[model samples]
Target: MGGNQTQTQFILLGITDSPRVQMPLFVLFLLIYIVTLVGNVGIITLVRVSPSLHTPMYFFLTHFAFVDICYSTVVSPRMLADLLSEDKTISFADCMMQSQSFTHFAVVECHLLAMMAYDRHVAICHPLLYVTIISSRVCWQLVASSYLFAFLSAIICTWCTFGGSFCGPNRIDHFFCDVVPVLRLMCSDTHSSEMVIFAFVTINVVGTSIIILLSYISIIRTMLRMCSAQKRAKAFHTCASHLTAVALLYGSAFFMYLQPPSSHRSLDKVASILYAVLNPMLNPFIYSLRNKEVKGALVKCRRRFFNHWQQRSVVSSRT
Candidate 1:
């Protein structure tokens, strides 16, 4: 009887209790998910169809779009579903999978963004050697390295979190299967696990951000030495988009993971939402709107799509 009561209480407490915010949160997340899908898919299609965007920079951009789609898909659908459902229960296996997928994409995004910085760095600092430096082989290697890093990070994180014993209450607060929320539900001592998570987060977030910063710093110094206002401005314009992305990603991640868990869980959830949902939705727009090449590609793709639709419509009408 005691065990049964304990289990019942745990289940009730573990489930999401924020009923009033459910509908509003659901609608908000649904809209964001739609926007994320459209923006990322649009970017992927534009990059693929546009011959002018076949270069390395646009290659990385396409990968970023793909990562964004994966990242948003990892968390948003489940989150949206949880909002509308009365029982916000996720199976232990499902939770672990969600956690792994989320972590993988999140880490991959960091590396991808860092690679973007390196690309800009090469383009700006070694304009003459840009082609030689970021060759097709080198680009593929960097992309593969990013994926490997993401996978390793995810493995470590999943092993750490899933190793914990969740005897009863399996409810994860917030929208998705984040490390902290899952750790909180653990019945075992999670101090060491949390520390390991913090260490990995630091390495992935702070470490990557530092490398990106150094690359950009070197690029900027080299540009300053060149003293060509037009070239410097152009480099800055290109770097600005990447820098914004870095700031959003690292800022949120560092804030969420670096702080002590007790005081900052709510803040972490909000910050996580920004990068997970908002960043993905914003990335394509930032690139397309600000980048001349991307904008041209997007415009060309749109015209083609519209023309194709019109042709189909005409055929249907004739039929």
Candidate 2:
């Protein structure tokens, strides 16, 4: 590392420098963060309480919700705070920490989406073997592997990114400490770092995307051969939410990271917000609204809550 690399802090140029927009953006993102927490927590609760949803599909879904919650938390709070503050500075260690968590969740999400697709394939194509194949042990293994791989990728990518000398501009062009934005600040030669980032991103993003695409292709084939229109509709309906979630996440993520860091700086910053903030908030609604089981569970839980409240109210009145 050099003098610049050893520098303690960097300024983050947020989405907009306009004073008028900061407060509005803060309020908006705060609301989004709250909703994100409520929705994801609701989904996890529903999955836990509803015995009907105690299957492999919802099992993966519960963890997916958890990941979304974590992903959003990592980026949103800091962004909100920065939006309110004029300094908008982040420590070098904090910068690397943000990058590490961001990369970890992003990579984990890619693999998890692919795994969900595979779970659907097994359930749809091999109905009888679904239970046998995607068992409790297998599900844990899949999740564990997703985390393990993501952790490893995070370690390598973060090391490569922060290992370089950031002896140049201390002002980052984008909002958060994303790899591309921070890389632009480094004075050291980053050809090797860029290549390493590209390779890891290719595997985590492009590779997982290919697997998801292939799984969906097989799923389509299996659906087409089915004689019953009702069954076909049911199948499509079941996978619709997952597909939407995949599109939102993958679309934004690829747009943010897959291109030259210098090109589309503004657009990339916006895309980063979409991928990191909005996507996580939207995921729970996407899954829960479209999912009948989740809806039913929510209704049941609501009824129980009201019933218990009424009982308490009556007792209080009597006392």
Best by TM-score: 2
- Shift in Å, residue 258, candidate 1: 1.4
* Weakest lDDT window of 10 consecutive positions for candidate 2: 1-10
Q: Report, for all candidates in order, the number of backbone clashes.
A: 0, 0
lDDT of 2 by residue, 174-237 (tens): 7788898888878888888999998999999999999989999999999999999999998998
Task: Kindly provide the TM-score of model 1 when superposed on the true structure, using C-alpha atoms.
Answer: 0.89
Clashing pairs in 2: none
Give TM-scores for every candidate, taking all chains together and pairing residue i with residue i.
Answer: 0.89, 0.96
Model 2 spans with C-alpha error above 4 angstroms: 1-4, 311-319
